[model samples]
Target: MSNPLSEAEDSPLFITSLAKGLALLAAFGAGRPSMNLVEMAEVTGLNKSTVQRSAYTLEALGYIAKEPQSKRYRLTPKSLEIGSGYLQTSELIERANPYLHELNRSTRESCNLLEPSGTDMTYVSRFASHKQISIHVPLGQRLPMYCTSAGRAYLSALSPEEAAAIIARSRLVAYTQNTETDPSRLAKIVRKAHGDGFACSNEEYYVGDIAVGAAIVNAEGRPLGAVNIAVPFSRWTLKDALADLAPQLVNTARSISNAARGLKPLVSPATG
Candidate 1:
């Protein structure tokens, strides 16, 4: 595929320096909470000088800080404002929160609201089950579309051709022994989700984690996101989940979709 950033590099309006600074920030993630200049350079594919400059700028802006002892740069609490701003202003999330809470209360299981971002689904909101569990999913987690129930549910709401194209673009790497990497088989699962009104994953992403999801659509039938309910494998079987929880999940998703249709359009440019 063509590199969009590379293509934009020559444009007069494109700010290479700003992009580099953002890339430096993006390099810090779940397992990588902090990094030294050399590590930043390696992760961001930037030179030491560029990493130093970006880190300096971020530190000055209070987005990141250099540790006194380790000299490793880490994001500051202020950096959370960026994500917090989104959560605060998201009409969809606000509308879905009450229903998500209701689902959580009724099922006493982990529930999440995930939105599509490219070939992956991103968690925008999450409610943890108080019950003992093996997995802990935090907000802002991103998982592959093909192997995740939420992702497949979102894809299932799309046209077959569109869903197939997205699956084609995915890496399809096996995340676990049970992860299905075959594109054709993945397509079949998506089709089943379309017919069934919900999709499920059987320990594809994480061991002992089973999840079912249904897509939230706009009035026009475009999928905006997905609502997911995840349970531990030791406590629930796929048959039990399908028989007991799928109806609730699908109904909750449908209710959210109906509510979302009445929301005003967000004042942001479309990413694509």
Candidate 2:
């Protein structure tokens, strides 16, 4: 059998079955949560016969269910279970879970682990630390990278030219009063974040929500993602938070980075 993935170097995601299975699930969207075989083929850009076979495979695996009346396909709760299993084993969640609770206990603010997905960022893992200023979103919530502290830190790893190009292509709307809309201004911020080893946002992405994040670098100094601490406006002033908490944020980032670089793990391994 010929390799479909090697045909496109951009997509190293080689496994045909896995790709088709995920594509089938992604075919269902907001307005069209349920899709027929033809609609799935249209959405996925796959052949109708391919969609039919994959849909059958997905249904057998309990990842999707066939709507008997509508003759449409919709994701099953089991699909979400598969995603949850990935989240459970993810290095981000494994390392950040305890720290999130600790930050919550000390500062009473929520914490999140963000992973860069192209020009977007996703909260792959998060812990609800504060009851008062909690934001509503699921585990896989994706948002614009240009407007967020976590996203900014990831962007910081890029060259100024590459960074500017990304920002230019992004939707720089005023998500909040402090959101940086100007491309030049945002580029400067990303550069500074690279230099400072941290990124800061004061009610920029979301109103009354301030966030701070630092880049996580691996052994080759390549950025892995970003770890962030979010505090509600009612919790602390920007001046006070930056002064008191910045050191902790930077230290935590360093710890995570070092761990990823084969340093001592945060959690001790089980002994036989």
Candidate 3:
């Protein structure tokens, strides 16, 4: 497949400087929250001078802030506006919020709305469980596609060829002892998810996190996102979760998908 960004860059309409500035901003994530000039250069693969210039520009724009004591640059509250802008405008998020809350309330587990991004799934919205023993996955966290129930649920909604292509492209690195890294085995899992109408992962992505998910499909049957319920190993077994929560999870995903079909097209389709 051709690179869309490369194609745009080759055209006269593309702005290289703007892209560089955005790349610098994206370099700061959950793992690397604060960074200095050297760290920014390494992460973005840009020269120190270029990183310095971008950092300065971001600071001036109030998107990033420099620590008074350490001089390390971190994203400011202003930077959150970018993601908040999307959430505020997203029809899918808007439509899914009520259902997500309901699912969380009924299941007493962390319920999440995830969208596929590259070879990972990004958590867009979550309703936390009130229970003391629960996994806390913050919004914007990314997990591997191959080992996550949400990712597999999205894959199960796609055509076999499309699903296989995505699996072929994934890194498939082992995140835990239970993570299935083999492409063939993972493909079989996806196939089963397609047959079962839902996907599940038992300590595949995280050691103690067990989750079940179903894809939210559009009118044309393409997946727009996924809804998942995550339970800790200490609280529930996989068999119990499937028996008790799977039906509700499937129902929630269907409701979200139906609501999503009535809304306008999303800014971008969920990708794998």
Q: Which candidate number maximizes TM-score?
A: 3
Worst 10 residues of 1 by lDDT: 263-272
Report, for every candidate in turn, its global Cα lDDT versus the true structure.
Answer: 0.89, 0.75, 0.87
TM-score attained by model 2 = 0.75
lDDT per residue, candidate 1, 1-272, as tens digits? 56555778979999989989989888889899989999999998999998889899999999999899998999999988878898898989999999999999999999999988778888999989879967777788889999999999988998898888788778888999999999989999999999999999999999999999999988878888899999999999999999998999999998999999865433111221
Model 2 CA deviation exceeding 4 Å by range: 1-18, 27-53, 67-72, 168-178, 234-237, 263-272
lDDT of 3 by residue, 1-272 (tens): 76666678899988887888999999998789899999999999999998889889999999999999999999999998888887787789999999999999998888999987887788999988779754667788888777899999988988888788788778878888999989889889999999999999999988898899999998888888899999889988999999998999999999999889865334233232
How far out, in Å, is residue 27 in model 2?
Answer: 4.2
Select the stronger candidate by TM-score from 2 and 3. Answer: 3
Query: Which stretches of model 3 miss by more than 4 angstroms?
Result: 263-272
Per-residue error for 37 in candidate 3, Å, reads 0.7
lDDT of 1: 0.89
Query: For residue 91, what is the lDDT in candidate 1?
Result: 85
Better of 1 and 2 by TM-score: 1
